[model samples]
Target: MKQWLQAFIAAIQFLTRIPVPVNVPFTNEVLKRSTLFYPWAGCIVGVLIWGAGLGLQLVLPAGPAAVLTLALAVALTGGLHMDGLMDTADGVLSHRSRERMLEIMKDSRVGAMGVIACILVLLLKWSLIASLMTAGAWQLWLVVPFIWSRAAMVWGMTNEPYARAESGLGSYFQGLHRGHLLGAVFSALMLSLATVYIMVSVPLEMAGWSASFAALAAYAIHPWWLLLGAPVLGMGAVWGCSRYLSKKLGGLTGDTYGAMNELTETILLLLLVLMTGWRG
Candidate 1:
């Protein structure tokens, strides 16, 4: 139990800027459990993202809800994942050797490819979220996607090999035990079930139960569908990172995994929002 607590705290430290007191001794085993916390941290990020959307509804006109929600997402996560997304984008598109790719990712300079990917992704998320708000499926927007996005992050961590040989985020999580896996999976399932129940129970304006369920079906299908897509995408990321590491420095590092998490979240959010809009 202490180890689990320690792992949770470590996860909070690893995934967010949130401060956590770490009096617990640092060991490789503790760090391994910390990987379980990454998904939960994503859950926290998702909640904040939902809160930001809610706050926007309260403070701004409906017309600007999407933009405000997008801003809040970046602000809540301190754009940490977004930065990784950009870096990974630049690296993946570089089409250079592995070493050069990693070098490009590490470089602070923004390339055209990275900039364009970031803009398009953000715009997609903003537009989808706005459409959901416009259609008044606001509560579904608040919960289901948030849980799935984090779960997707866990899927990425569990399936992908660290692109690098040492000192990277993937390396830290390598070969995590079944206990850690169960912890992440269980937390994610509980959150997902809760979100689904709320979506099913919550009334959207004057919409009938049939219509609400129909509308929420999109969100319901997202995580399961993405269960297939995320692994494919995650594999691509791992492959890209691996190539970059092998060609450049002989392996992946922690920051690269950070890049993977960010990209995965962005894609997952965009997919969920779009599906929800269609159903709503």
Candidate 2:
């Protein structure tokens, strides 16, 4: 139990800026094992974002709520994925040689393409989130996107080769075996189930069994059900993305991991809007 707790804490430390206030060994083997809890860390991020979204909507308009919530997502991860998105756009969209593309991604300077990609991705997320909030789709299902995004990163990292030959943060995860991927998906599923329990049991306690059961019935139409299939859908999408990026840059890099995450999160959000708000 102590060891698992340490692994989970290591995951939170690696994935977010959240101060866990625990001492854990930072080693290659620990880092590789920490991949198991990436989705678990993502579940924490998802729950926080969902709670904030709900609180924000109560006092503020949807537009400002969307902005703040989006900002919170970036802040939690210290803009790590956003930086990757920009770096990837600068490299992949530049149409340069594969080697040169890799070099461009490694460069710290952001280019025009990178800026544009960041802008577009943020805009899409902002619009989708605002629309969902506006349409009153504040179900726990919203958390799935956050969870799947990180899980997609784990899926990509475990299954794909590292682009860099010698160095880069992505290389540390190269030791990941099949167990890491299995554990990640399992963690994501367990997190989703816990969310279900929270959403259902809290309402049951506060409003009595009648109201709780009614809320349960509403799951028929809730996007939360998609949580069950996200492992398959998210991994498949990440696989296709890894292959595409690998064809261009030879393999996945740390930047591509972030790129995959941002893209997957946005795509999943778009699907949520379709599933919940686009009803006839």
Candidate of highest TM-score: 2
- Model 2 ranges off by over 4 Å: 208-233
Clash count, candidate 1? 10
lDDT of 2 by residue, 1-280 (tens): 8777888899999889999889999777888888888888888888889899999999999999999999998999999999999999999999999999999999999999999999999999999999888887777878888887888888888878888887888987778888888888888788877876887788889989987787656433445556456456766777788889989998899999999989998988887776665344
| Candidate 2 vs. true structure, TM-score | 0.91
Model 1 lDDT per residue over 146-193, tens place: 444544455555545556543644565677555665677677667767
lDDT per prediction? 0.64, 0.86
- Which residue pairs collide in model 2, if any? none
RMSD of each: 4.9, 2.5
lDDT for model 2 comes to 0.86
Clashes of each: 10, 0
lDDT of 2 at 195: 77
**Alpha carbon lDDT at 188, candidate 1:** 66
For model 2 the local lDDT of residue 224 reads: 58
